[model samples]
Structures are given as C-alpha cells and as structure tokens.
Target: MPTVSDFIIERIREWGVTRVFGFPGDGIGAFDGALGRAERHDGGLEYIRPTHEEICALMATAHAKFTGEVGVCIATSSPGAFHLLNGLYDAQMDNQPVVAIVGQQGLASVGTFNQQESNLERVFADVAAYVQTITTPEQAEAVIDIAFRTAIARHQPTVVILPHDVQAMDAVTPGAEHWVSRSSVAAASAAITPPTEAIAHAAEIINAGEKVTFLVGAGATGATDEVLEAARLAGAGIITALRGKDVVPSDIPYHTQQLGLLGSLPSLHQIKRCDTIVLLGTNYPYGEFLPATGQARGIQVDIIPEHLGVRYPTELNLWGDVKATLTALIPLLRAKEDLGWQEKIAEEMRGWEREMLAQTEVTFETGANPRKVIHELNQRLPENAIVTADAGTTADWFGHHIRLRRGMRGDLSGRLATMLAAMPYAVAAKFAYSDRTVVCTIGDGAFQMLGMNELITVKKYLDRWENGRFIVVVMHNDDLAQVSWEMRTEDGNPLWEGSQDVQSVDYAGWAELLGFRGIRLHDDASVGAAMDEAFAHDGVTLIDAYVSKNVPPLPPHITVEYAKNTAKALLRGDPSELAVIRDSAAALVTEQVERVKGALHLGGRDDDGPR
Candidate 1:
C-alpha cells in the first residue's frame, strides 16, 4: 500500500516537474519520504533548496519562463505559503507558467486557530490563476492536473493547497494515466475574416496613411516575429511597452522607443505624426498620448476583449491570439514596402537612440561606468547566464539596456520592485541549475537588505562547490539612492534631500571576511577584468564597482503626468530651489556634451554606466 505522499510525488513527476524549489517546513516534511522515492525513480525530478520561499518561487518562474514548462515550487504551512506569495505574484503578473504547492496545517486546525494554519486557498486566490485546497484524498490528483493545465495552458501561475493531514493520509495510487498531455496554444485563421467591417476599414486607412506606427505589448509578445513582419508589411514604425521590450532586439531597424510613463521621444513624436496607429497586442496605459483627433485610425488586436478600447479608442478591435491575428492579417493586407516610411522612422529611432545614449554619460566622468561595465559583462558572458537584479538604479538600468539574447534568463521582482531579492534569487538560480552561471546585480543600498544571511546559505553548499559558485556584483554608487541629487534651499538655504551620502564600506572585504574571494573594481577598465576573475573563481565572489551617485534614473519614457509632477516640485522647491535648478542644469549639460561626443567618436566620460 502506497502513501498519499507517494501519489503526490508521482503526480509531480508525471507533470514533468524535474526540480522542486523550496525551503522545507514541518508541515511539508511528511512529503519528504515521497520526494526521495520520486527522485530515485525519476532522474530528472529532484528538490532544490533555497534560503527563502520567495526565492524558490522566483527561481521557478525563471525556469518556467525560459523553458515554457510548468515550473514547480512547494512550501510548508501558513508562514511558508506567505513567503512564496511575492514570487508567485511575480509569476502571475509576468504570465509565466508556474505551479506552486502550498502545504496547509491539518484540516482539524483549519478553523481552530492553530499555528501556521489559515484559509491558505483564500490567501492565494488573487496570486494564482487557479487556487484549491485539497481535503479529500480523491480530489488530489485531479487538483494537481488542473493546476498544471491552468499554468501551462493560460501561462499563469497556479496553486494547490494541501492540508498536512490530507497529504499524510492514504490516497489513491498514482500512475502515468494521471498525467495530461501537453498541447500547443491554438492559432488563428490565415484568412482575416474581420471581427467587424471596421477592421477592414481601419486596415485600409493604415494602408493609405503616410506615417503609421505600431505599439507592441505583452499581447504581441508571442507574435513578435509576426508583428515585426506586419510592421514591415505595413511600412510602419514600432515601439513597445516595458513588457514588450524583450520582443524586439535593440538592432531592429524600425524600432522606435518604449512607451508609457517611461516612453521615449521617438515613440511620442511618431505617435503624434502618424495618421494610423496599429496597436498590436498592447494596451498602453496613457490614452492621452494616443492620438484623439480622429485623424489617426486605431486598430487593436488582443486575445482579451475587456482590454479593447480601454487604453485608447479602438477603431478596430480584432479578438484572437496575437500571432494568430497577425498571421491572418498579413495575408489579407497589402505589403506597403515603402522605403521612405522606413527611412523616416529609422531616422527618428536613430535620434532617440542617440539622445538616450547621451543621457547615461553623467555616470562615466563621475568615474566608474557601472552601466558600461554591466553592458560589457552582458556581452561577454555566456548567453545562458542567469542574471537576477535587485530593485533600484541597478534594476532600472538593466531593464532599460541589458540585452537578453535567446538563451539568457533574467528575473526581477516584477512591479513590486522589492529590494533584497537578488541575492536570494541568485542563490536559488545556482541551486536550480548548476551548469548555468548565476550572477546577482544589486546596488549597495539593496545588497545590504539581505546581506550576510545569504552568505550563510551559500556556505552550506560548500560540498557542492561546483553548483554553488554564485557571482555577486555590487554597484556601489555611494549614495542611498543613486537617482537623487544633493539639494539646497532657495536663498542659499540647505534642505536635506536625496540619499544622505552612503557610508563607504569595502564590500569586497566583507565578502572576504565571509570566507569568499572579493575583488574591488573602482574604474571602468577594471570592471571587465574583475568580473572575469570573479566568474572564474570557485565558490562565491563579490565584485564591488564604485559608481557615481549623481546619475539620474533615466527611464525609457516619461509622461505628461511625470512632467507635471516635476513642475509642481519645482514650484514648491522653496527650500532647495537653487540646488534643484543646478542639478537640472548639470544634467542638461551632460546630455548635450555626450550627444556631441558620441557622434564624433570622442568620449569625455563613460556615462553609459550601471549600478
């Protein structure tokens, strides 16, 4: 007679969960026996331990996002389950295929107010696409199957809550029959039978327009190639949301700029000039940025109907999978391979690219080009490098400029943008896949959030040094927050603002103190050499790059709302008006100098720096 834990582990294997990432707890220990048996039976299925459950979930998300498989994580009772929420939320928000197994307190304790017990299902309802608590033995297998299907089919995170009592009981035997077959997401028809006649009319308007633009969002991620093909077909320029940046590589010819609050000038300028704007799988947040004069015909393609007409007034809304819709529309549409349109948009893209490059120059002359260092490391590292970023200027810079090639796996804390996740995430990444190089990019501010505790966990893996060699790059910008400038009040009065000058600490010395190798890179030239050494060194190593704190957190885009906020701040800057003005002037001068220097192939500062 097999135990229910055996059945659960069998189901996990059948669902193709090779590695389970999580920290163990008392409630989950009952399944440990089954996990051991499953690992013995299936070579691919193993458990990977992390310092925290959030790291477990985040690591699973990265695995799922890259492999397109259902990433699995298991956590113990209430406290453990709660810890997994952040990573699960990230998975859900990013639409990554992931399934989390949460162990609840025994059913007898559900309402009795026992320790580590609550309605775990309700707690995770919003975080998971499908959430279920298993009290009956008969429902276990089906619940697991549904969880997998929900994650794999809809590309959303799913959760299965298992009470310790139910998990410990004798359940039905598990076998291959319990597994569901994997299926591809359905595609749309080649013949674009317009969802409505308005679609055709809008297409005609776009075909006739002199300047056309495409806004790509998450909806268009799957159809990136198709969308690009359509952009080429329609002779239009293209920009993407932050979510869609991964869809287009930096070298794409007609790629304009990313839009939103962080959007760039090329996208905004083109949006104003275009007579037709085709929204591909994107729901841009700012409707005001969208043309409203009725001169620009708006065509939208999205799988979700509710999103239609929400961001901007849609002249045509075609509901379907992004790739499917594009495939169908491409055949029905006339390819306007207009060289003039491409050239015009390309010119705008070039100008914005230059301006964008110029904005990063301030960090260079301030000395260490942290951005340039990261850029070089990104280029030099293996494509399969696993990079985890902590929130702050580090996360912002990487999100804006880090080029993620096909095999690279990058994970962030979604919009919550929590600090201290990088170290744990990098630890988990190393634990999850020993063959891949796992690197954590964190700011001095953020690195301290989870500081020495993470090192203890890394030390535990000393027996498996090959699998535990984690590389950490601490961007020491020497300010509490690198984006803020020192300020003074109006009439020469001082107002305390910005990160108080961060205390100087030798981060490398700290790492070395913890029995790990530490290297300090204070200049741009040494960054590459230090990282290479760190990567080659066995076990944990830290590369602390001292960067300038004066550089602004230049977003890819800025909106009218942001400008208005700036104006308000300016008007209210009675305490530090002069300093704020000086900071603005300095930023402008840096931008101008870099713009001129870049074109002439002479550089004054290495401004394209990172944290």
Candidate 2:
C-alpha cells in the first residue's frame, strides 16, 4: 500500500501539474519527503522553494496567469497557511486556476490549542472555489480530485488541507489506479460552447447598432485572433480592461487602449460614442465609464453565466468559452461596410498618443521623472519580454506608457490591486519561461513591503535560470506616492504627517549585497545606460532609479470636482503639494494645446511631435 503523500503526489502529476511552489515547515515534513522521492524519480514533479509563503503563492499565481494551467502551491499550518492569503486572493480575483495544499496539525489535536493548529479550510473558504480538509487516507484521492477539478473548471483557487499524521498513513489502494490516470483528470474539465439561440441573439444585438465597441478582459486571453476578426467584421473599436491589456497589441488599428481609472481618453471617448457595446470575456467593474444603461445596447460573452451583465446591463448574454463563442458568432454577424466610426476613433487615438508622448518628454529639474523611465524602458523592451507591474504610481506609468508587442505578456495584481507583486511575478515568469526576458517595474514602497527579502530567492535560483534575463527597475520615490496623491486629490485633505511617507533605502546596495548586478540612477539622463547595464548582466539585476515624488499621475478625464479638491489641497500651504498641482496642471494644459495643434494641422508629423 502506498502512503497518503504518495497518492496525493501521483494525482497532482496525473493532472499535468509539473511544479509546486512553497517553503518547508515541520508540519509538512512527510509531504516534503514524498516530494523529494518523487523528484528523484523520472517524470516526477519539481518543487520551487521561495523565501516566503506569500512569494510562493504569488509565483504560483503568476504561473497560472501566464500558462493558463493550474498553478499549485504548498504551505504549513496556521501562520504559514495564513501567509498564502494575499497571493491566493490575487489568483481568485484574477480568475486564475490555482491549487493551494496546506499542511495541518494532527487530527487528534483538534480544538486542543496546539501551537500551529488552526482551521485552514475555514480560512481559505472565502478565496477558494473548493476548500476541504482530508481526515482519512481513504478520502485523499477523492478530495484532491475535487480540488483540482473545481479550480480548473471554475478558473479559481482551491484548497486541500492535509493533517500531519494523515499524510503518513497507509493510502487506500482500492481505486488508486482509476484516480491516478491522466484521462480521468482530463475528463473532469471539458470545453463549453454557447447555445445556438444565445449566439444568434448576441449577433442580432451587434448587427443592429451603428457603432460597436469590443471590451476585452482576461477571459479573452487566448481568443485574440478571433476577437480581432470579430472587431474587423463589426468595424468595432477595441478597449481592454487592465486584466485584458495583453489580449490585443497596442498598435492594432481598432485598439483604443484600456478603460476605467487607469484608462485613456481615446478609450473613454470611443466608449461614450459607441451605440452597441460587446463585452468579450471581461466583467469590467467600472460601469460609469461604459455607455449608460439605456444609451448603448450591451451584449456580454463569458464562460461563467453568473458574470454576465454583472457590470453593465446586457441585452444578450452568451455563455461559453470566449474563443468558441466568437468562432460560432462570426458567421452570424453581418460585415459592417461603413468605417467612419472606427476611423474617427483611430484618429483621436493618434492625437492621444501624441499627447502622451508630450507628457513623457516633460522632465523634472531635481530627480528622474517616472513617466520618462517607463517610456525609455518601453522603447528598449524586447519583443518577447514578459513585464509585470506593482500597484500604485508605478502601475500608473506602466499601464499608460508601456506598449506590449504581439508576443509579449503583461501581468499585474488586477482586481486585488496589491503591492509588492511585481518582483514575485517577474521571478515566476522567468521560472516558467526560462528563455524569455522578464522585467518588473516596482515602486519604492512596494519594494520594501515584501520585495526586499524575495530578492534572495532570485539570487538563490540564478545559477539554475538558463538563458533568462531578469531586470527589476525600482522607481524610488521615497514615499507611498499613490496614497499621498489620493489624500490630497480624492479626500481633499492635506498630506498626512509621517504615516504615508517612508525613508528611502540604498536599493542598489541591497542588490549588490545579494550577489546580483546593481545600478543606481539619480538623473533622467542615466536611465538608458542603466537599463542597458541591467539587461547585459548575465544574472539577476536591479536598477534603482531615484524618481520625483512630487510628480502626479493625472487621470485621463479630469472632472470639475477633482479640480476643486486639488485647488483646495494646494491652498493648504505645502510646497510639495503646490508644486505637484502646478506641474500636473501644466502637463494637462500642454496636452490640450498639442491636441488643438494636431486638430488644426499645425503640428509636425503625428509620430514626430515633442518627444
């Protein structure tokens, strides 16, 4: 008879999970022993040990997000299991398939106040689609099967709790052969196609409108070609949610950038003008940016039926795989002949691009401008690069500036909006595709959160990272810049004392101490050289760029209320606040001036503006 640990490992391997991420702990000794045994044998799974459980969880989430496969992570009981919550929540919110295996105390110690004993099933219930604790060896295979099936089928996180003693018990062998087969696992996940009536109804809604817009999301990841074909047939402008930024290349004629808070003016303009909005695989939460309920007829397509019309009221809801639904609906849609709306949106997009270039050209007198750093990085980024960004001002610059090419991949915390995810995402992207170039853009505050220590994990695995180039660009602004901006602009309050401000660290020195190449950049002029140095370095590298904290990330469409709040905040007599407000106002004015110049045909070549 095989041990419970062996049975669990066999089932995971059978499900095509090749790697597991986590740290070691006493509660998981038996599971760790089984992992070692499996690794020693051919065709067995490998273990990726990150420095912290949170990093492990993040790596697993990134792996699933990038590969579209089930990402597996392991952890010990209590605090160790608790550490996985943040990253698991990222996976949950992003709708990625992730399975977390957590070790628990012995069954006999239940409610006995043991040192590492806690109810992990209850703790993970909110974040996981399925959460269960295995009490007996007989239930091992069944529980593991349910967890993997639920995660893959629902595209969400799943949890399996394993008690210490139960993991070492004799496994039930009666149905082991059936449970450990690849076909059995594959059968649990089947493809879904929308019904004929639903497809016809969606096509009818799209054909009735004069101006249609395709709003993409993470659900549209692998359906790019199909989505683009649909856009071409319908003469629709394409706008993506932040999670769907990589669905279509930025250079596409119909592509109008992203929407919502971290969105573009071109996208917002197109959304307002469109008569019919076709939501493809995205449940974009900001319904205000979309056409009002009665203004535009909406048609939503998604794999999950419940997500339909949750964001905006839809006239037709098509439930199925995005690619499959698009394939079926293409034949039913009447090809749009008039290209007037698409052309107009494209022209406005060009003007927006020119305005954006002008902002990138704006320089600070004291420190590096964060937008410029992102622009330079975007220019030098490899075609096959995998870029990840942390939340805050760093994401603000990256989301607005970085132009992801056809073959590139971009990852962020998405709905979770967590900080310190960029570094771990970069590491995991490198781990998943060792030959690709991976770059992570992070803020100074995010770097300090959990990124500072995780560098050691990158250094530890550097020798094994074959043909991969890892570059971390730290935008050191010396404070929680996003929070400060929110306080002044959103709340109409003065900057808080020391609560949101943080002391800057020698990030370059820290990188050097960890046995990686480190480059510190103090001026805007050094950005290109530092980027080159970091990329050329054989191992992991960090480019510590000192950026201006006074620079603000302006919204695409400024409102009267926002302008009033900003004026009141600036009047409170903080020099830095006043400087930021003045600079932002100037930038806005310059952008509007450039737009007006372009409209009057008084500017240079569209692409050869100020930058």
Candidate 3:
C-alpha cells in the first residue's frame, strides 16, 4: 500500500529522529515526497536546509552531544557527501554519535559518470565508523536499522548512502515498527575499562615522589567526577588542556594549571616541579614540554589501546575506560594525608583565577571587554543554553572565559578544528531543543568562511516565523590575525611573517543584507544594550562587536618552555622552526596586547567600532 519512501520514513521514526537537517536535490526527490506525506500524518519530522552539507553534519553532531540522542543529517548525491566529510571527521575525532543519510544518483547512473556520481563509501571510509551503500529497497530498511544501532552503540558516526532509483522502486510492503518509548536504557559505562594493578603501582610511584601531577585530556569527557576523585585521593595536582577545561573547572582546589603551548604560568611551574606525571586520556601533540625519557616516568591510561604511547614515551600503559579505571583505582590507592603541596597549588590556582577576572575589570569602564561581555552573557544565559563556538581565537577565548553553568553544554570543531561549524550548529540546536537558547560565538575570519551560506537557511526559517531559535555573535576584528600570526616571524621580516593586512570587510552590513537583524556596536557601553535588542528581535540576529585586531586570547594553560622556544625560533630566523614558533608567539603577543591595551584604554574607547 505504501511506497519505498514511506518505509524509509518509518525506519527513521524507529531510530527516534524527529527532525532532519539537510539540503535537498533531485537525487533526494523521494525524501521530499516522503516528508510531505509524513508531515500530513503528523510524524513530527521536519526538514531543515542549511547552507553547506558540512554544516548540516555539524549541526547534527551538536544536537546529539547536547541531547544524548542520535542526531540525523541528510544530503543529496556526490557533491553533498563530499562536503559532509569534513564535519563527519570532526565528529569522529570528538566521539560524537550521529547518523548521516546521503542520497545517491539513480541506479542507472552507476559506473556511467552521472552528473553527481561519487564513490561515497571511499570518501567516508577514513572518517566514519560505519559506511554502507543501500542498493535494494529490502536492503535499505535493514541497513538503515543497522546504521542507527551502530552509530548509537559505538558513540560514533555512521553514513548510509541510498540511490534515488532504489527509493523510486516499489515492491516490499512497509512494515517498520517504531518504539514509542523505552525505560531503563543503559549508560555508556561498558566502554570504560577497569584499571589494572599498574594504576596502584603508579600511585605508589606518586607516593614516593615529592611532587606529582594529573593531566587530563579531551578523552576524559564523561569521567570528570572520577578524575577529580582520584586527584583528591592521591593529593596530586591537576591540570588539563584547553579541550579538557570543561572536565574540571579552574576553580577546583587542587587544580595546578593547564599544559601545552597555550598553558598558564601556574601549569608550567607545576609541570617543572612535579617529580612524576600521570597522564590521563590525553594524547597531547606537543611533546617538547613533556619530560625526557628518564626524567619523568609517564603512566598513560586510555580506553583506546592504539592511542596510548602515541605522543610521549610511556613507562606504564593501562587500556581501559577513564571513569571505570579511575573508580576501580580510587579504592586501591591511599590518600596522601599531607596537604601542604596541594594547598600551595590550590593557592596559586585561586590567585590565577582572581588575576584573570581582575583583568576584565580594568576594561569595564571602557565599555565591553570581550571577556566581560562573555561573563555577562554566561550569567544572563538560561541554565541550559547551548553554545556552539567556531574555530580560531574565538574558540580559545570561549573555552577559557565562557563559564559553563551546571547544565549548560558547548560544542566546537573538536580535535580536527574545522571552521564554519557554529552557525549551522546553532540552527540545528534550536530545532532540536527549542526550550534552550542557542548562541554562536564566531571569529570574523571563521565567520567569513561559512556564515553567508547559512544565512539563507536562517532567512528561510525566520520567514516561517519560528520562535525561540538561535542568535549569532560575531567578534569582528577585521583580520585573519590568527593565521597571519602563524605565518609571522620573530624578526619582523616581511618575507618571514608575510602580510598582516586583512581586507576591510563589513560583516554586520553583510548580515543585514542576508535578512538578519544586524547591529554594529561602536562602543563597549553598547554590549548589554545590543544583546537586549538581539534577544527581543523576532527571528535571527547578528551582533557584530568591533574588536581589537591585534588582541589574541591567551588560554590559561600555556607553558614557559613553549613560550621560550617560540621566542628562540623567532630570534634564530630559521624559516622552518620559525613557522611553528610564530603561531605560539603571535598568540601570546595578541593576548598580552589585549591585557595591556585594556589597561591603557580604561575609560577611553568604547568596546565597539575601529579606533
């Protein structure tokens, strides 16, 4: 009685997908027909068309991360699938669960070089946990079911490509049944492995050492509580990379500091003082800061076996889930009763937090310090506001300054650090969780890369007058300073660092043209006023803050060695090593300038407009 399209929609319902994010084309014409029928039947599934396929995939990833459900995204044929690859790679690296359904050219076009022909299976092979092409209508239903389960079970992304001709064929009866509800679903605890005797032995090594440290990475996502428990028991100092900041707040008592190129002074100090280092769930790429082979015996633990010993030499490697391993080891390890060392570290952490907070105060009289604006935004935001951050300096700043409330969630480009994911993600976040406000903080450089195409989707949805959606806040500094700094040299040679002049582009005016209620803030005094106007406006709004071009964010986790080496590379004038050093120095310089400028500009310039 029903066509193949109806059967596919039924399967999607079974997978608990109520909304779909995608771009439709002729290859996916059957999806449109099916959507029309499903809407008439009150299926609750609606299609949202984003600007690019990559954005569509990222939106789904954000939705899944926020809601703990399988987020669905669709695309049409080869071009669409190719675009989806970048976002899917990001999701894979971040370990987010998502389902991507791509429409392929008709069966007749197979091996015939059709207009949109593509080897989608190969395209997604490296990025996806599961990639399959559904050829027949019968196989389509079965493979779709498998795709959903694989994506959810593994907490990984899966791609299903179907030919338009397959959906047009009519043979099998539609019999896919949906699970309306289920109780007592299992948590992802199985993925975590129990810690072996190595952890206990490693704790003994800590007991022997006068100074010990704990460094958490992005892989420690759900194990924050467990990691904290272990740290407290061992009386070991704690630190994390920027990606792991959300794992443990900077306010924690024993928190030493973060490590890496962007690490803080406190973290660098602790790294140097510690006699033993216990690495947890982090494969940090910068190996220069790590202790040499004999100095610090590194004990690394991770659920994924292949990731262990990739970055630094490991004295001991334990393969297991971070939370489970920590839980098992906590009981076996004895607490260090002496709190003198930990107390000192805690004092430094508190002092650092206080100093950073005070830096924003100096800029308050000048009207919106970006940091202060972020803090205020964090306060006014709803308890469950979902923030999607774009790549570059905006991500670094947001990671450090945008204090996360107990229930709030934030999504970024993950380990791959792709650009232009925030806008579409905000759009999808709105559709997935209308109860929560969605905010996108993007750098001017990153926004210019992908914001225009996404605005069309925003205008389309706003014309329909949807309520309680998303808003974008652009830090318009008018320069690709982040990249330029990476290319710069310490010697100030034009041939070394190249050009820093960014073309003067008015992003806010462009947003206005794209049908968003756009506002260009000319002074710091207008941040709150502009925010008020933005929230009150009906559809989408863009608040463009004219920020300092040279101000780069200094994350609370940068190290001195990293900083010194950066200086050396610049001083040496070695084009090879200098290229690497320039990025770190430029980042530090940018942040230092902002700190110094904020002090100098006290009560001088507004936070808006070019000085």
Candidate 4:
C-alpha cells in the first residue's frame, strides 16, 4: 500500500515538477524516504539540497520565474519552514508560481509545545495564495492537487503543510485507475479571455488619445510579440516596469527602457508627454512617475480584476490574459500613421544611451567604476544568459546598464526588494536551464549577508550542472553602499561612523577556499581579462571587483529636493566627501559633453563602442 508521502510525490511528479529544493529533517523523514524511492525509478523528481532553507525557497521561485512552470520546495517543521518565508515572499510579491511543502510536528504534539512545533499554516498564510494542512492520509492527494492548481492558475505561492504522523499513514487507495488524468487537469484550468465589451472599451480609450504610451509589466512576460504589435498599432512608445524589463528588447526602436527611479530620462519624458497610458499585466506601484489622475486617460489590462485601477485611475479595465486580450483587440485598433512622437522618443533614448556609455567609460582613480564593470559584463554576456541582480546599487547599475537581447532573461526582487537573492537566483536559473549561462551581480554587503554561505551550495552542485557557466560578480565597495548613499543624499547626513561602513574582506580568497576559481580585479585594464577568465572556466567562479562607494546612483532627472539634500550633505561633510563629490561632478560633466557630441554625430561612433 502507498503511504501518504508516496501519494503526494506521485501527484507532484505527474504535475511535471522535475525538482524539489529544500533541507531534510526529522519531521520530513517519511517524505524523504518516498523521494528516495521515486528517484530509483526512470523519470522521477530530483531533490536539490541547498545549505540554507531560504536559498531553497529562492531557488524554487527563480526556477518558476525562468521556466514559467510551477516550482516546488520542501522544508521541515518550525525553524526550517520559517527560514523559507523570505524567499516565499519573493515568489508571492513577484507573482511567480511556486508551491512550498512544509513538514510539521506530529499531531499528538500539537498542543504540548513539542520540539519544532508551530502553526505552519498561519506562518505561511500571508505569503501564500492558498494554505492547507493535511490531517489525514485521505486529504493528502486532494490538498496537493489544489495547491498546485491554485499556484499555477493564480501565479502565486501556495503552501501544503504535512504533519509527521499523517505522512507515515497508509493512503486509502483509489480505484486502480489514475486519481486524476492530465487531460482533466488541463480542462479544469483554461486561459481566460476578456469580454468583447471590455476589449472594445479599452480600444476606445487607447484610440481617443493622440499620443499613447504602453507600460508593460510582469503580466506581459510571454506576450512580447502581441505587446509589440499593440504598440505599433497605437504608434506608442513602450516602457516597462522593472519586473517587466525583459518583456521588450532594449534594441527595439519604439521601446524605451524601464521607468521610475531606476529608469531612463527618455522613458520619463514619454510618460510625461503621453495623453493616454495603457497598462498591461503590470501593477506598477510608483504613481509619482505615472501621469496624474486627470492629466492622462488610463487603460489597465490584467488577469486579476481586483488589481485593475488600483495603481492608477483607469477609464477602462480589461480583465483577461494579456496575450488573449491583445489578440482580440488588435483588429479593433485603427492603425496609427503618425510615427512623429515615437520617433522623438527614440531619438531621446539614443541620446540617453550615449550618455550612459560615456558614464561607463569614466574610470575611478583607485578602483574600477562599477558602471564600467557592468558594461563590460553586458558586452561579453551570451545572447541567452540568465542574469540576476541583488537589491541595491548593484541592481541600479544592472537595470540601467545591462541591455537584454531577445533571448536573454533577467529579474531582481521587484516588489520584495530584498537583498541576498542574486546568488540564489543564479543557482536556480542554472538548475532550470542547465544549457544556459547564469550570471548573478550582487552587492558586497548583500553577498556577505546570506550569499557567502550559499557559495558552498554552488560548489556542491557545480559538477551536476552539465552545460552552463556559473559566475557570481561581487560589486565590492566594502560597505552598505546603498544605505549610506541614502543617508547622505536623502537625509542630508554624513556617513554614519561605524554603522554605515563595513570592513573589507578578501572575497576572492573566500571563494578559492570554497573550491571555486576566484579572481579580483582592481582597475579597468584587468576587467576584460577577468571576465574572460570567469566565463571560460568550466566550474563556478567569483569575480570580486572593487568599486567606488562615492559614485551615487543618480536618476535620469535630478529633482530640486535631491539637489538641496546633496548640497546640505556636501556642506556638512568632511574634506574627503567634498573631494568625492568634486570628482563625481567632473565625470558627470564629461559624460554630458559626450552625450551632446553623440547626439550631434560629432565624435563618438554611433554603434556600441568597443568593449
């Protein structure tokens, strides 16, 4: 007779989950045994063991993000399950489909305060779209099926809590036939199409305006062609939220880069100038960057009805799948002939790209410019590279500088905005697509936080990765650079004494100790060679590139509040801070001059200059 654990594994395998990431403990011994039995079979789920439970959750989330498949993770009771919260929240906020299976203490110990006892359901409630605890063997299969279905359909995290005793019980065998066939599963969950009236209303709102801007978000991930077609039909300039950065290729003439704080000047200009804004599959949280309530008419298209008009006041809300809605609306849209506005925005983007290139060209006196390092990495990155960035200044440089090709995929902690996710994301990406190169750009502080220990996990899995390069680029500034910058520039305070500054560690040496190639690059001259070495290596590699902490993540447009704060900070700061600001100012001036020259076709070449 099959045990409850065996039934659960069978259901998961049938649902096409190839791998489960987590740590095993006493509470999950029965489930682990079932996993072992399955692995002996021909095509069974592989259990990936990460050193930390948090990383396990992160890996599962990234796996789903990259493959568009439901990612699964498991953890033991209490502390093990608690550790998965951070990564589970990443999946929840980012809207990735993931299912977390957490083991709980035996039912007998529920009220006795036994070891590792806690209410797993309550712990995961907020981070999951659905949470269920299986008390009996008969409930196991049903709950697992529902969890998987809910996670995939809603594109959110779901949790199934399995107590120790229940997992060990004998499952009530159903009729000899399969419990649920694949055909039944497919029929139960089908794509939703918007009503004709809703689609027509959205079309009317979009057609009414002379200048329309399409803001794509994560919801438009697989509907790139449809989005581009819609943009072309409306004669619109396309701008993506950070989560939707990979939705539209940067090389496309009509597409502007990401919008908001880490956005380009051209995108901000397009947003401000457009008479109408069409939001597709993206609930962009920043309303300040969007057109005001009465200034521009808004049309929002999303799968979830509740999210409609929640971000911006919309005249029409088309609730449906992005691709399906666009497919139906295309015939209704009158093809726009006026390319004048789009052309203007394209020119602005060209100028901004030139400015960015010039900034990347500027070298620091001591260490390598972080922008230059990112630019070089971008140049050499493979067309199909899976890039991940930590939340901080590293993500700032990545969002602005790293251009994604048509086949490339990348993401950061968009809504969660948590640190120490880059490395775990890379590991997950590599596991999902072993044939593709995986690169993670992380800040020094973030790397030290949780990424340092995860390196051993990478080392453990190095041999298992068949055909991919795993590279971790540490933006080493020896401090919490982003927080320090915020303190100085936003709060008008000098760098706090011991709180903001961190002692420098030999990260490359640490990488070497963990059985991976470690390379440290201090200047621009060695950057290319270091990158080449890291990419060419067969096993895992870490590049600890020392960068300047003084260079701020300056936005596309500088505001008056920022200027006043910067002025206050400079006045109150020491001589060193003054010198740093002076150097940065000089670099900015040079970058502006280059931008002007490029715009006028005077000096710099039009093409992306040599790496």
Best by lDDT: 2
TM-score of each: 0.80, 0.95, 0.80, 0.94
- Ranking of predictions according to TM-score: 2, 4, 1, 3
What TM-score does prediction 3 earn?
Answer: 0.80
For candidate 4, the per-residue lDDT at 166 reads: 91
Query: Which portions of model 2 show Cα errors greater than 4 Å?
Result: 175-183, 601-611
Residue by residue across 1-611, what tens digits does model 4's lDDT show?
Answer: 88999888888888888899979988887898888887886546888998889988998988898888888999999999999999999998888889999899999888688899987777888999999988876567668888888898888899998899998899864434555322223414435778888888888887777889999998888999999998888989999888788889878886888887778877887887789999999989988899877878998988877789888888888878898889999989988888887887787788778788888877677578898899889988887888999999988898789999888999988899899999888888888888889899999889988898888887777777887478899999887888877776688877765787667899999999987889999988888999999888877889999988777787877678877787777788633476567656867686668656755663443333311
In candidate 2, what are the lDDT values of residues 424-527, reduced to their tens digit? 89888888889888999999999999898878888778776776478899998788889888888787777775677778799999999987788999888888
lDDT of each: 0.69, 0.84, 0.69, 0.84
Best by TM-score: 2
Total clashes for model 4: 0
In the order shown, the candidates' Cα RMSDs to the true structure are 6.3, 3.3, 7.6, 4.0
Better candidate by TM-score, 2 or 3: 2
**Model 1 Cα RMSD, 1 decimal:** 6.3
Candidate 3: stretches off by over 4 Å: 3-5, 153-155, 171-189, 195-210, 256-258, 358-382, 459-471, 489-506, 509-517, 524-541, 552-611
| lDDT by residue (tens digit), candidate 1, 477-551 | 666553342132112223334444557789988888888998988776786788778777767888888875545
Work out candidate 3's RMSD over C-alphas. 7.6
Higher-scoring candidate on lDDT, 1 or 2: 2
Candidate 4 stretches greater than 4 Å from native: 174-190, 574-576, 594-611
Q: How close is candidate 4 to the true structure, as a TM-score?
A: 0.94
